[model samples]
Target: MIAEIIPQSSALTKKYTNFYITNLLILKNMGQVLGMISAVLILSAIYFRVGGQKNFSNGLFIVGIIGEILFIAIMIMAIFD
Candidate 1:
């Protein structure tokens, strides 16, 4: 009976471990994507500035900043995890 319980508990533990790992993977990928998006937005903002679209450029810059913040948050979470 004890042996059966041990195997069952271990299996449950492994399932939970796998779930956490999957979530961590998703978070890591999301952070990477956010970083890429922020980079692109910054570049686009620069392009817009050169093209004289101040409004759109500003908007993109704001969004880019938000993305950068999210990326940073994810990085912090990763460090803690």
Candidate 2:
């Protein structure tokens, strides 16, 4: 009885652990990609602003800030999940 229970519990733990790790990995990758996009947008926004395209620069800046927020949220979720 004891041996049977131990094996069953261990199997379940292993399965769930794998699932958690996989989810964290996916989230981490997603966050990384979003971070990169945000960085590019911010840099372009600065370049455009310097080049005298105020309107377009503002739009890009807003989008980049939002992307940065989303990336942070995803990273937090990955940690808690």
The top-ranked prediction according to TM-score is 1
lDDT of 1 at 16: 68
lDDT agreement with native, every candidate:
0.85, 0.87
Candidate 1 lDDT over residue span 1-81, tens digit each:
222334435677668667777888899898999999998998999999999999999999999999999999998886577
Candidate that would win on lDDT = 2
C-alpha lDDT (0 to 100) for residue 27 of candidate 1: 92
Off by over 4 Å in 2: 1-10
Cα error of candidate 1 at position 79, Å: 2.6
- CA displacement after TM-score superposition, residue 71 of candidate 2 (Å): 0.9
